[model samples]
Target: MKVTIERTALAKALGHVQSVVERRNTIPILSNVLLQADGGALILTATDLDIEISEEAPADVAGKGATTVSALTLFEIVKRLPDGAQVRLELSSEEGRLQVSSGRSQFALAVLPEDDFPSLSTDDLETRFSMPTSDLRRLLGKARFAMSQEETRYYLNGVYLHAHTDDDAPALRAAATDGHRLARIDAPLPDGASAMPGVIVPRKAIAELGRLLEDAEENVEIAVSSAKIRFGFGAGYLTSKLIDGSFPDYERVIPKGNANVLRVETKDFAQAVDRVSTVSADRTRSVKLALESDRLRLAVNNPEAGSALEELSVDYGGDPLEIGFNARYLLDVAQQIDGETGTFKLADPSSPTVILDEEDERALYVLMPLRV
Candidate 1:
């Protein structure tokens, strides 16, 4: 294969595809990227058996052909080249090497047969829909923070996406939880998506999708099935295998009858928590919240370290309540609140607390309290 492409365009496409290639692979071809030169563009594809990413970049094709080369190696070479440089790639079948040249620099990388590269098949993707990239980005971004990292509950290691009804209106919901905290965000359901089956998008795929969406076009096409999911941007697409497990019924954990309500300035509450938690234990990182009439006290006491206390005026008229929560978890949930006022619905110190943003009714968060 002989093709010439701009350094900037080649590097961008390589950067997108190489992210899915594992650094170490038992199968030799899995570590390489498949380069297909045809038509007026070069298609670069990389996969790790479970996930595949492919991108097309405009190129000058002198001889149309295909080959495989180390993804990281090629990416590094293209990235280091000076801006506006033209990159030329030629495959020598006799020597089994791919020659890469730019200006006065040249390198020969060992090549693998493109036929050996694995692909995640999307032949069974029965549910296909298109949604605004911004809407999809918000749904995944807001809830992905709560996805579980522990492997014991493998099913919880992804965001659960499904069609649902919010106040009798059809909506698409994304939810994730790690047992201690939960995040649920909803968006208007696109047409023809009501019959889509619920699916758990693995954490790694969620992260990759998030990065890709940053440079994606205004709309993104999505296709889903029982076992896999695909996201198609205007220039390229990503296909990933779905987690083969059932996510828990998360709605049960959300409390609906919490009577205690506390409305505090989001920034003030977050800052006060950050200040008091400075002396908290590293393991627990617990911060205590003592609430009364209209005042809230934040405190952290560690015998080895020191004690810290801060007070903030809040809008609360419920009975006085004291609750302890992980400082880091509190900050994470608070960061998701886009409004100036963050409302907390609490029943007791032992029960879960519901956190909401005053301006966004479509987003909800639940935090499990810790014993102080």
Candidate 2:
């Protein structure tokens, strides 16, 4: 392949697909990106067996050809080249090398046959839908923090997306949990989304897909089948294999009849949790929250370290209740609440507590109490 492209455009396209290439791979071709140049455009494709990303950029195509080269190395090379310089890439089939030259710098990179690269198919998608990029970003961003890192319960390692109804209106929901804490967010269902099937998007796919949605105004087209999912947007497409496991019944985990209620500023609660956690040890980083008629006190006690206590005025109507929770968990949930006040529904000290953003009714969090 022989193509000439602007340095910045090439780097941006490489940045989109190179990260999906695994550095440590048993197969040499898996670490390389497939480059195809034809008709004044250059297409870059990369994959790690499970997820694949492809991006296209405008180029001056001297010849129509395709080859493979190391993704990270090419990314680094293009990144270091002088800005606005025109870069030329040419493949020497006899030498099995790719020639990269920009201004005074030149380098030869080893090339692999494009036929060796694996291809992910999207033949039979059961459903297809389109939604605003900003809405999709919010759904994934709010629930990703609660996704499980432990692989033992592999089913809990992704966010569950399904069609749901909110306030008698069709809505799309994304939920995730690690047994200890859970997060759920909902967005208004877009046109042609009523028939979308439920799918569990793995943690890796969630992160990569999020990076692709930087432009809020752009629309994302999503296609899903029983075993795979595909996201197509401007100048590119992302394909990922589904987890092939069943997610747990997340609706049952959310508490239903929590009576006690407490309302406090989200910022105040997050900061108080951060302050008290300083005195907590690594193993048991627990903070106790004592709620009374109109006062809330957050305290953390560690025998080896010191103790921290902070008080905040809140609106609490139920009887006094004392609860223990992981300081980190509290902070994670509080940071997601964008409104002025955060509302908490409590059943008791031992039962799971539910938190809701007063201004954002579409999102809710459930945190299990820690035994202090």
Candidate 3:
């Protein structure tokens, strides 16, 4: 393969796909990126068995062919080349090396046969739909932080995406939880997505997809099946294998009868929690909330460390109640609240608390109390 491409364009495309290639691989070909040069463009693809990413970049093709080379090495070479310089890639079959040159710099990388590269099939993706990129971003971004990192509950390690009806209007929802906290976000459902099956998008794929969305344009095309999911941007696409497990019925955990309500400024609450938690014990990082009338007291006490206390005026008329929570968890949920005021509905110190964003009613969060 002989192809000439602009350095910036080549680097951008490589940055998208090379992330899927594992740094270390038992199969040598899996560590390399497959480069196919043809039709006035260069297609770069990389995979790590479970996920595959491919992108096309405009190029000047002198001779059309394909080969595989170390993804990391090629990316590094292209990144260091002089700005605005054109990069040329040529494969020497006799020497089994790929020649890379830019201006005055030249390097030769060992090549693998393109036939050895594995491909993730998307033929079975029966459900197809399109949504605005911003809507898709909000659906995944708001709930991803709650995804479980523990492997024991394999199904909880990713976000649960499915179709739902919110107040008789079709909506798409994303939910994630790690048993301690849960986040549920809703967006208007796109056309022809009502029959789409609920799927658990693995954590690794979510991270990669988030990065790709940063460069994506106005709309994103999505395709789903029982076993896999695909996201197609303008010039690139990502295909990932779905978690082969069932997510728990998350709605059961959400409390619907919480009576005590406390409305506090999101910024003040988060900052107060951060201040008090400074002296909290490292193991628990617990912060106690004592609410009465319109006054809220935040406190943290640690025998080895010191104690911290802060007070904030809130909008509350419920009877006096005290609750304990992990300071870190509180801060995480606070970051998701986009509005100035966050409404907290509480039943008791032992029950889950529901937090809502005053500006965006479509977003909701639930936090479990700690035994402080």
Give per-model CA RMSD.
1.0, 1.2, 1.0
Candidate 3 residues 1-372, lDDT tens each?
Answer: 899999999999999999988898889999999999999999999999999999999999999999999999999999888889999999998889999998889999999899988999899999999999999899899999999999999999999999996468789999999999999999999998898999999999999989999999899999999999999998989999999999999899999999999999999999999999999998899999999999999998898998889999999999899999999999999999999999999999999999999999999999999998
Worst 10 residues of 2 by lDDT: 209-218
Clashes of each: 0, 0, 0
Give the winner by lDDT: 2 or 3. Answer: 3
Residue 62 of model 3 has an lDDT of 95
Structure candidate 1, residue pairs in collision: none
Clashing pairs in 2: none
Score every model by TM-score: 0.98, 0.98, 0.98
Q: State the lDDT at 294 in candidate 1.
A: 97
User: What is the C-alpha lDDT profile of model 2 across 1-372, one tens digit per residue?
Assistant: 899999998998899899898889989999999999999899999999999999899999999999999999999999999889999999998888999999999999999899998999888987988998888899999999999999998888899988886459678999999999999899999887777778899999998988877732388888988789898877898899988888888889899999999999989889889988999988868999999999999999898998999999999989899999999999999989989999999998999999999999999999999988
**Per-residue accuracy of model 1 over 142-206 as CA lDDT, tens digit each:** 99999999999999999999999646878899999999999999999998788899999999999
TM-score of 2: 0.98
